[model samples]
Target: MDKLLSLCMIVRNEEKVLARCLDSVQGFVDEIIVVDTGSTDGTKEIAGRYTDHVYDFTWINDFAVAKNEAVRRATSKWILVLDADEYLDPSEKNDLRSFLTGLDAGQPLGISVPIYNCVESVTSGKFIESSAIRLFSNLPTVYFDRPIHEQVVYRDGELPLRSYPLSIFHTGYLDTVRKEKEKSSRNLNIFKDLKGLEEYDYFTLGNEHAILKDYKKALYYYERALTKKTESMTIFPYCRYQIVLVLIEMKRYKEALQYIEDNLKRWPQYPDYYSMKASVYVNLGFEEEAIELYTTALTKADAPAGKDKRFWLITPSLGSHIPLMNLAKLHQKAHDFQKTVYYLSKLVTMNVNDHLVLFQLLNILVPNESVASVLNFLGKIFDFGRADHLVKLLHVSLLLGNKELCEHFHQACVKQNIEMLAQQQLLYALVFNEPDRFERHLPEAGSGSSTGPLNKLIFLAAIVWKREDFSSYLSPSQDESDPSLELLQSMFATLFHPEEVGVDLPFDVNYISTLLIDLFKMGYYDSYDWLIQQYPQYYFILANILGDYFYQNNHLQLAVDYYSLLLDQKQLSGPGYYHLALLYLYQGETAEGLQFLRSAIELCSHESHWYIRYLKHSPATEEKKEIARQYRDRFYPYVQINVVEQLLKGQA
Candidate 1:
């Protein structure tokens, strides 16, 4: 414990994250050395609180200079470098000192630590991991090099390296942080001004371009990195990898496929290359090849990665979750439930906290199986006893419309004495079809928009009794291509905004079609009819479901009225004609029944019942006899067909 590690950081205007950074590793380090380069904010004050070694240097637009200055002040044997926006993961704090001392002495001068770059919201669990030489020997021979994306270089040629399991979370790349600093522009401008740059500079410039969404420039720089004289550069594979990504983002899939195919030959051990190749094949519409490649990728997923110097940029999920998730999605699109479940269940087993995958899995299983069976199947993947697991289960269950499962999870929450969220109560009531419970939680229903699961059920319940206050809950759902939220937002658009047209409902067309029939049962026919007329393309769905509902309810007159509309509109099929004829017959309208029965038989000529009824009704004129003779021969003589014709002849 003789001052084994010193925390060295270079900061400028990082007051927001400086304290959080220093606080995370302060316990692990012997002393803190901070070099401030023109921070006009409270960055220095916060750094001073953690260490007296806070020294200010003139701004030189070079990261290496500031970082070297911080390293110069360290009294410890080992230097642990960090940025103001980066913090040592608290869970990994205790492992630092033991890991430093435990390192095989005199072998590795530079120790790379795993850094997680939080790309979006920190709470979202979305991040990319990379290794950086943050830990190094504090000897004078080992100092920092490069201006941006700086690296630790030993004075006497190539430095022996080792990777440590030091988890550091970097928030500098977060959108809020990026916008505050305008750091992308700063980095890009710095890279742009430099000439006669190295392979690392070109690679770093490519990343900067990619950040700015200038894919062409990114591709240009990445290619330049590959073409440079540095053949054995550690970042060479990454340069090629980034080139493929830039090509992909530009939708140049064919070009990407060739480069990635080449990359696979060189770095065949990395599963991400296969995954990327599969993604390219997907874009090129080679679905089977994509599937085959993804499966092949699984075989190589366990290949030594990140730990290897040749391919340090290993995405852990690429080998397992990425390929499995892709395969699940592919099989799901093909409607192969068995394979979809097989792949998704694998993903769920790996990451139980993956709620998106859990939702997709439940979506497949919940609709076809019983609640008990689904819960049992999911129980293998989840511990229902845990409150967080129970909450996720309850959420996904609601999304899948598994009422009993939602109830089961909700009740489990109750057992845990967990504070039931208003949203949870709303979902519980909605799923269980309890109007009273739903009303109790109405005020707390944060989102009742037409797209939300809560609103879908609320809208269904409202339109079920839609004669009541349904309009207040309806809003125009903007389905800008995010699949989970893409719903038939405009299903009730007619009722709410009658004049709005041409906003087609893609995902929830069936939901609204069935809802229309339910509304008709509750005497809410006008609104549903308006919905159908607005998107008249779904009239066949409305006709089929509404006709069945009318028949099932013993409402013969309403059935006749609805069917007559279909017949009048020429939307009625042969079965629809026969169905209408039956309704007329039930109503004792023999003449109308005869006309529709003949019309039914004319279109659905194979129905012997229609032939038998038609023959019984009409006279045996030559024209009628001709119809009978034709149907009998054309139908290849079902016993009913011959018997109906012969019996009619005998009666004549």
Candidate 2:
């Protein structure tokens, strides 16, 4: 039979993947040409199973040389060259053959096949799609170049390259395989030995350095590559993109911005440049600008064909995923929870395995919206096998006050081997309202078996349920001299024992806050105080809740203390500053009070009225009034300065 297609490959110690590659293209090609470059394994024997024409070649450092030798031995109209780690997708085989049947041996031409490069472990990891000219006419002029990262170039004529739907899966770049092969070190050594470097040689060297995370060297070579880049060089945009990445990695945001801006001007339609600019904006805290740029990048993400080969090297089809996730997180950071949920929902539709996005969406939704609303959405996307999703279901059920749902999920969690301290706490809280049920779940009070941390936590739960009145332990009129040290000391003794506390107490902020709020509701103020006093390290959770609690209850001094603790921990909310300042003013600390007022204005300008109230109360000098007037004009420009002016004049 007249040969139509020749499958050409160079092998060395590729026995592990050789059979899989050959099996994928079993009946697709006419002849197989395997060029063995000194294999020390069963690679040649495996090659013998697929083809009878396995030839021996001396091992050299140059991959191009070995690859060219395989092509040289092919005797067909067309050649399909690939690495042993790569295989033609079986689904794409028929399409590939149909496309090939339409072409003739008129001129040297190449078909750019999409390559999916898997990383980490193949079964559980992600892939990056790239395009490579692995299929071409069997012309003597078409050959590979460079020593390490080779490319097929038609030296005799202009090889008109076109993309096809055919795809290949390459797994040699997987972390597990790369670790065993040490391919980067081998490529780097070969790259270093090459003399009279071309533009691409520099780029390849930069890529090698990038793989090793030597950003400084990568940056230098990428810059050098750009200098030598020709007007028609397809790699120019990729080099620009990589230079920006290297700059960003080096924390040189200023330089990265300049380079990206210049590239965007030169290649305004390229989404990759805009995507990078958005990242730079995020790094610099220009979140709104980042959101704008990311949105702009999404609009331009559908990259046009024949623009650049490097563009096809990455999965341009779903390149928007990166910007989408970035926008979701940026909105999350800005506390635009609606937009956060919107983007995260979109991401979940694309990949349900994005558990982090699911977790983030659930976290915001359960607190902001009703339980029914969250449950309705979770029904569509929930996967019980995912422990994190079970955790979400457990929390949502508890939040809805659905004891039956909580118990159902509790059994599901245990069955699924999902054991968490938060789960136990939630279960304990579900039955705390019923005396009999509460005691049923709670550890025996004062029982020696309940001395361990887990049981001690249960004992605490019992106290919250058993004691409804704490007024006697906490009263303003209590005699300071009446040191009823007995009750206090007994409480301290239970808490102070280190061994009694379980090693695996899940001190999540939400769960801890929930526990504290339950105690406050049941009038167990002393018990709440005991927990906070004993675990002062976890007081940020309590402080956040208590700050608002005290402020709303008109307990100014208590509000001030908790808010100050939160501020010291960098966990203060937008209203925390204003509340703290108001408390300070109530205590006659005018200087500190005004300082926090300014902070409040800077943080949330729309809430400047909070600061204005204190200015309306405090007797301020002209200097203080001028400071307030400036802040109002700067942050809240729509507000009338005359109103503040009149208040400062003490006439209003």
User: In model 1, which runs have C-alpha deviations exceeding 4 angstroms?
Assistant: 10-27, 31-60, 68-75, 84-91, 102-108, 116-129, 139-142, 154-161, 169-182, 302-313, 433-652
How high a TM-score does candidate 2 get? Answer: 0.60
Q: For candidate 1, lDDT tens digit of each residue in 17-63?
A: 99888888867889999888998999999988998999989977788
> Of the candidates shown, which would achieve the greatest lDDT relative to the real structure?
1
Q: How would you encode candidate 2's per-residue C-alpha lDDT over 1-652 as one tens digit per residue?
A: 1587899998889999999999988767989999998999999999999899899999789899998999988898889987899887677677677788789755789888777877544542256666678898888898888777788898976778987767788999775687678888988888778888888888878887887889999998988887644446766766777788888898677678778788878877656777787876665435566788888777776555354533322345224667788988766544456888888887776666555555566656654667567667776777766787787666555444455556667778999887645324534453445555544444333233322333334434545554423222321213333223343334434454546655543344544555565565444678777666766666666687777766654345677788877787788876788767755666678788777877776777665445455565556566466656664565443233333445545422
**TM per candidate:** 0.66, 0.60
Task: Tell me how many residue pairs clash in candidate 1.
Answer: 0
